[model samples]
Target chain A: MKKQLQSLKRIGFTVGMTAALAASSLAQAEDKLKVGLMLPATGTFAALGTAITNGFKQYVAESGGKLGGREIEYFVVDDESDPAKATENANKLVKRDHVDVLVGTVHSGVALAMAKVAKESNTLFIVPNAGADELTGPLCSPNIFRTSFTNWQPGYAMGQVAAAKKAKNVVTLTWKYAAGLQSVDGFKEAFEKAGGKVVKEMTLPFPNVEFQAYLTEIASIKPDAVYVFFAGAGATKFVKDYVAAGLNKTIPLYAPGFLTDGTLEAMGDAGQGLLTTLHYADGIKNAKNDAFRLNYAKTYKSQPDVYAVQGYDAAQLLAAGLKAVNGDFSKRAEMVKAMEAAKIDSPRGAFTLSKAHNPVQDFYLRKSEGRDNKVLEISAKALADPARGCKM
Target chain B: MDFYSFLIQVLNSVQYGLLLFLVASGLTLVFGIMGIINLAHGAFYMVGAYMAFALSSLTGNLFTAILLGIPLSLVFGAFLEWALFSHLYKRDHLEQVLLTYGLILIFEELRSLLVDDEVHGVAIPDVFSASIALNDTLSYPVYRLVISAVCIVLAIGLYFLIQRTRLGMMIRAGSHDRDMVQSLGININLIYRTVFALGVTLAAFAGMLAAPISSVFPGMGGGVLIISFVIVVIGGIGSVWGALFAALLVGFADTFGKVLLPDFAGAIVYVLMAAVLLWRPEGIFKKG
Candidate 1:
């Protein structure tokens, strides 16, 4: 009886394999759009990745379960925010899954690895969150487009905006990383050019949360303003600690939008009136934004944050490219051109792609008001990355 | 830095040192007493922080949340000891490390599934949220001061328990000769289980107390775990007093390093550890 049962199970497995193989060719003829989501699905950046995925899926739903009149199938891989596994994961998407396009990533290091894979595979990749300047500046590719702001852009904008606000002497604090270094460099350049002085710079190693000693230093130095770069939990702690230290009252605290992005929920009243610069803001009054916001909140059951805007715009960018090529992705050049020239009327604002394929968008000077980024004004308009050293 | 600034940093160092002691105490206990190298100790801390976050929200009171969190943590720790570590008492260090490392992964995945990866803040109770003004411009958070005070009380209590109590006597005897202790009919298994559970509870309690200032999140455990291991090693494994002294040394070194050499702050702690090792190869408090 056992032998017969084993034989019967073997026969069932063979029949199922035959059915799936037979259907493969039939399904291929339909030519569904394959999108690979290589975001960090379960780590420090998991919430950011979740927002990006949500925005991407919401657009697909809004577009009647299709992008560019083609049914889309998604292959999602959690990048785990480990730079070592990033290329391996991207290779799986490009080689193993043969995905038509790749959408990813939150960590700058991991995203850089993904960019390398995109370059080698010539696979169209949309960056939803990571803002490494090198992706557009030195290693810009015709195949890559970023819906997010570059690391330098918003920081530079913040520097200028703060300078205009009469914060002539600012002290900067952040974790030491490519993103942090580049952001501080960008801020210093603009701030000094606007006749400001950076008294001193202090940076701890990346992912370190203890900031009390540094807070003491800042209090002692007593800079006119504090410009910091922190994200997620670090940002939450820094804001809370900074305020608790009583520095915010005397030394106006400023940072790139990362200090507030997706962190307002955790920050609570601690972030109120905290001015920040970012490519997206809450009070961007427009029909396009209204529709996107309504749909996103309705779908996700929460207010859409900046990260979600980037993800939604990523989907919009992809849809535009697919539509321009009439969903014939085989016309790779035309699709790439379409994506490169794509003008996105994002929830943030109307942003067009630069020659380097990074977003040439307005940076909004926003003030955090009761769990919302109230748009004060445009800090910088139509800011385009220099894309220095890029042949493109 | 001015005198006032230096004074503030000193306070920062002490506050940080006390918190480190709270975390490393439990790590040293299990390593010193139970003869088990449990890398999953940090996972217990992370879970405690997570539990505090959840219960604080559900109970709407930080004190009440902690009241519920401790026993729950104790029970969880006891369960882990009974189910897993009890069998690993005689296992080699490498096997114990590998097993506990696997447990860390399991606990992290379990946490992620249950809580997702959102950073949650535990609002300090009103009583502890107040600030003590050091000067016109410099003020310290009351929560931090409270943390230092609580850790002092804990250290004294832990010292008296280990030195004066019957369980402490048994634990000391077992650490010296487990087989002899067993032969003496002292239920060595129960002692191991109790010590292991107490260590876990202490680590979790540290996490709970820290949630307000640290702001609970994923991967927070890993950082504390590394620092705790450093404390255990430098203080001599299984020596609570060594853990305390080493923790304060690291805390002061780290705080001063960050202020003096922000760029090299990350390496300074390890440098101090290396220097200490060069002086005393087996740690400052290692016995025999």
Candidate 2:
């Protein structure tokens, strides 16, 4: 009688475990859309990653918590700001979790690594940032789509503008990194084509706080203008030091809008009258961008940066593609086709994909001025990205 | 190269070397006397810079800012020792390393929370902002020259204090034989605290001098900290004059390495360090 009771209990336990498994599968099938976000969430680039995550969240909330009628699930993994770690995380996201789509990564090198994995898996990779030109040039892949401008786009546009302004002698100070090298190179090429002479070229280290020696060198050079290629804290430091070095009155400093922002509000009047070029400034007068600016500020209680805007656009583009495929991720070719159509409304009027599947968009020239201690745009001009040999 | 241009570069190297000595000395002192490899020493330097920034902004006087910041840093050093570091005195080297590493994390996080990661840098004061023209073609910042002068004065003062004073005698003794001095009833704890505070003050003053030239931001201390550690090790860990000489060696190596082999600037220092260590494992100046 005891043996009979033990057999019955074992049967009951097995049935309960099977039932739980069936329930979980049913729940997952009904409401699953796994999306992966890989960014530098834990290292030096954490500040930018946090901003990207916030924007990603804002987009999900505004999309009614669903994409293509399926409950959206996102795995935001910290890549630790390393390219190798980014690749490792990408494997886990694709192989382990079986995420249908991937988005994110702000570093160009990290983005390139992920692009390789996405190509291997035949997964749709929506890059919201990472501006290396080679990603869309010789390194182009069919599985990747970028909503952000390429590394060369803004600098090339700025070069043309500087040439138009009839600037003669220009000095360039850029970080000693691949992205910095490409940006400065782009500027140099375009500026020379525009009939401007690059008098001096200097490369500063990343996250470098020291500028005095370089500034002293530039002072000695006494160029007609200085073009800066530094982003993040480097940008903040460059602007303050430029002004404080009292070069404001002596030499004109020109940089991309990535180097200046409402964050300059922290610098007070020190940020005033700095000239820059960019793809989009917060002061853009376009109706679509204007609305985005208002909604973003209302939601986050802070000004939306280029990273935030790119994040929002990446989500919208993914949603459009999913909608076109009728939520069928198994139809990978169809999804890729729909994404290549580039039908979403980006903040910068409209950014349609080029042959490389990278966005062919407008770049802007802007200047920073202050009112009520706020960094405000005092001037702007729009220009388009120059066509290059990039076949995807 | 022409003689004049060569002279200018040499001057640049020397000025940089002198500035490095200021920070490396403090590191050497703490490590030599206390046997605590304080990695967060660089964070104290950063704190000094921030203090100078705040005080300068508040008082609109450069001299006043330096004066206020040095004492504040000294007091902070004392507080840090009393609250946390003292407990690790009897522990092994690994514990001291972990605790100091934790301190670095806490300090960096606190700085980020307080100031945000956006860059913060102090500017050269108006009176000293002009560059001195070496010739019609070359000019150098007056501020760098001022930094070199200040470093020289401090170096002289430190030499006098260490060689001629009674406190210096006790510090030297403690570094060589802490247990023996303690048995002699020399109040070892008090001496350690004072020595640590002095070391911290020197590091902070270096930071204050550096702020006008470098960008001040979270994690800014990390680079300096590593370099100072290398300087301490290469100089025989706790040797003051060794630190000075090693610092100058490093400064020259860095400046010249960048000019000659820009791609290998990061590795040159380590390569030099390895060569030195291979020659003398206990360093140029050992405990004795």
Candidate 3:
């Protein structure tokens, strides 16, 4: 028994020494700025995550394969849209790889976890896509920067558009979660202010696609318009069911940008004439979008959507920050300040960062046009998210 | 809700329950007769949807795609039975679950490789695309009604096949005593394979039929798979009638819950399952 214990202790010591040696060797071998991506590699947000990666890579390549003349290396961990496993995945990149800047995440729940980890470690965090309002609201931090729209920004714009169209009674529907609640709250804030009555509010548990009962209820309620907040497969199913139930003819449907993005390709003709609000849209009549879209298609063999644009802008923000610090990164405060101050000539529009680090950008009022978005109106230009409940 | 709208909600519940019944029927049959927990059952459903998507694009007809897809599903199911599931028959339930789960992973990966994991909608045949006006303000979809009718006919056919046929007698007997049936000189192995293959075919058909309404996407099968298992457990395992009744009970509970109790809609299905488990640990129906 004594001999066995000694051998076990010796084995444990050798294993620990080997791990330390390997980690040290890895650090000695790489002299590049480490960028870690923790994004959903599969499930509901996989395509968005892929687009973000592609967009980021496209920006890096355009900047001569370096950000501010510093070579950047990447490590990726799949968040899988699972909030429970999110901290572990982010920590693997933050502590193990010791990445200088962590870019992530499409699901808001997972993003919340990533933001928490970034806050604890003081790691520079650039959000590529998730849009829970709390990220910029009460949970806002100096080290956390978002290149995406808040859940409120687009929803608020949709409310303004609905009010302008003379909608008196509207029904709001969404899943029950941070993103869904914030979206409805934002819409309600603007719609009620515009003298519209929210007749009824309905929500399903998050990630559940059973919308039949709700569809029947909507028909009975007979609202002037339905303001829905759903994305990915849920969005696809809702649009189809809505049309099938013949509610689309009598009542108009409005949603935030995510309801239509890549989902239009799947929804086909059912998606036509649907009005949504977002920061980015296709056919924006700008040289920046032209180049971004063309090169994105040429490289990835698919047209880039709003998610890709957010991803490209994330790299753009990082590049701007690096340029400000002359790539030294040790001046952490200055790096963040530079990032906050930088003006981005994005595919969406010319935009700058807000005090809370979320984008202050134009919201495009877009109509779905044959598997693409045609910009109809600019709902709010250089619009800053209210980011209510934020102490920062 | 008004009476007319309540009626519409009832239709919705029935339609949802019928879809569940189609998938759960196969799951219960395979579990009852073969005594194997097939987690890859959902993968077969996904395969059917993908098959319809692929063949519809090729043939330019949804009905024709489904017809061609059925044989392919049967062949694939039979191949699975021969290559992998056959060995798992006598193994422990954990081994069966693990092997089937592994199959689900492989199936998902292959689907991703082929279809790029994006949502794709199937067009409902134009003939069934019209709606029945419920009142001046509302209407019910014709395709949903047609789906329900077809499911009813299929249910009747399944009932007749099981209760009034030689094959069903052997299946029922095998469910009760596999070793005894084998000892009685019936090729019980052949019956198990047939039952397994038929179960796969039923699930695949449900997927094909549901494609137009649900919109096929990656990870689409996971939710239905979980729900189907709940149904199988709450209904007696291997009892088709039990699955049908339990599915309807779940469907009504879920539909009513969503309309009446929106916050707890997702939990209501499981709540019903738990209540049933508490009352009858073996399930709502007794084993044959």
Candidate 4:
């Protein structure tokens, strides 16, 4: 009878332990927050995507690997910078993985598609890099927020700078794409407002780097200055070609910051003394920026660029919302309200969201100097996107 | 545009055309002689550009980089032909396409692994870096002129190699009847290998020449490949002279089209291709 009682006790202990373990795991699952990161991991934008991921994870890791006392679980999907696969890729994270919040994307077209998916599912989405105007304009929603500027902001700011410099008749050149077109429109809006006339606008097909024919045309037009919108390898080639063609000697070239940002190193001496406007520069002096830059360099072994800053700010915005709602995503409306209203202390500096949920930030005029985009001045202070078509 | 500016535009078109010819001549030769469709021809161009970037940095001179890169690419071409392309010659067009297409991906991935995805600029030699002032506002880079000159010399060399030499006769006969040339005990396989190597060398050499001006970057090959194919198609599949003519025509159309019809500039090349096909379905020249 004693041996049988001992055996029964052992069985009871085992059952009790099993029940407790299951209960704890269930609670942990409920408490943890799921975040899906859909960004390009391959193709042209791959490096940008990796930097963004590092910045996001760096913020999370700084908060002891949790946000607002909730453990963060991450799911990643490579959108491949292909807009055609954007819907499918986003769905894999939202409907399939059932993530609570979605963060993505560098390519504007892919980001727009991801925004569509996020809206249909009523999931919270934060755009880290893409600057598509429609995201904040026609498609604005309470659950949608962007940590980056519109494609219009930097261009418009540069236009003001160019006008102040007394460039009376300017010519513009860019690849014929939505981003390029919108950027030129923004420049035109501000320049024309400042009594500056655009003499000519020339464009080639997208991803075509052959600019000799166009350079020849620009030479003949002889505008006071030339403005262009090109990024990555195209930007590098254009700057080199422009200098090589001796156009830079005769015509002052201007652009939004993308012309010199990640491409300055490859551009070598060709990009020297070139001026551009953007939301971030390498020499912003503040305790916040200083500390952020130091910590990022320590963690990643590389200096954080505009993309990394945007990614960090996305996490910061999410953290603000999570903190307000006490880590309960069921209180999503309250969380989103907190996100919209939060004044994020970004590495780019402090910025607040506009009514359309785009960043209302300062745009800086930067000069390319020795592989650095050195800050010249604040070109536009507290610049807000018009968000022309938004009802929200 | 004034006459001087028009002259500048013509000069630009010819220079651009010559560069395209350097790449397309190889594509035509490979197709015409080897009977193998090399989709990775552009990738070879990219490889050459990257080689220019890598070797120039090491040797500290673009000229030396080209000098070293030629023999290396020749050996690479021969090895590729011996190991992979030789097997594909006996296979169907679909299989050849599949293999060469796979090669493009492999080459791109290898490039990424070796060089990373950052754009790199190869410094132009000091001797050729200056620009000749065309007028008060416009000047053309002397490097571009050097490029045209080199391409012209290579074109002459290629012509002589194919038209004058005993090897050229053998190559011509082989293209006409491969079995007959083999029965003549000419070691037709060795000839094919030499021809393939020469084609690769030309394409790579074009890439090297373009590197300083173009700014080496990922996917640089893709654009050039499509245009090269158009040149190949328009010039007729196996005709080098036809390729030269077609490339020049394309260059003029593209340059003029950009000036006159900016909105339709992108479609102009394809439009030219469509017009050519309608006029001569097999292209501008008959097969060799």
Give TM-score values for chain A, per-prediction: 0.92, 0.86, 0.93, 0.93
Clashing pairs in 2: A209-B215
Q: Is candidate 2 or candidate 3 better by DockQ?
A: 3
Native-structure RMSD, model 1:
3.1
Off by over 4 Å in 2: A1-26, A168-171, A195-201, A204-224, A238-251, A261-271, A371-391, B1-4, B53-68, B123-141, B271-288
Q: Which digits, one per residue and each the tens of the lDDT, describe model 3 over residues B1-288? A: 888888889989999898888878889888876888989889988888888888888998889999999888888888889889989877899999999999889989999998887889888888898988877666778998888888888888887888899999999998888899999999988888888889899889989988988889998778788889999999989877888888988889999999888778889999999999999998998574
How much is the lDDT of residue B249 in candidate 1?
93
TM-score of 1: 0.94
lDDT of 1 by residue, A160-272 (tens): 98899898789999899889888888899899999999999889987888999988988887788988999888999999998887777788988998888777778766878
Name the better of 1 and 4 by TM-score. 4
- Can you write out model 3's per-residue Cα lDDT over A150-245, one digit (the tens) per residue? 989988888899999999999999998878888998899899999998999899997888788888888888999999998888899999888877
Poorly placed runs, candidate 1 (over 4 Å):
A1-23, A26-30
Per-residue lDDT of candidate 4, residues A1-392 (tens digit): 99999999999999999999988865777778999999888888889999999989989988899887789988999999999999999999999878999999899999999999999999999999999899999999998999998999888998999999999999999999989988998999999999999999999999888899989999998999999999999999999999988899879999999999888878888989999999999899988899989999999999999999999998999999999988988999899889889999988989999999999999999999999999999999999999989999
Report the TM-score of the second chain of model 2 against its true counterpart: 0.95
Model 1 - which docking category? medium
Cα lDDT of model 4 by residue, B182-246, tens digit: 99999999999999999888889889999998888888889899999999999998787889899
Displacement of residue A128 (Cα, Å) in model 2 is: 1.4
In model 2, state the lDDT of residue B94: 91
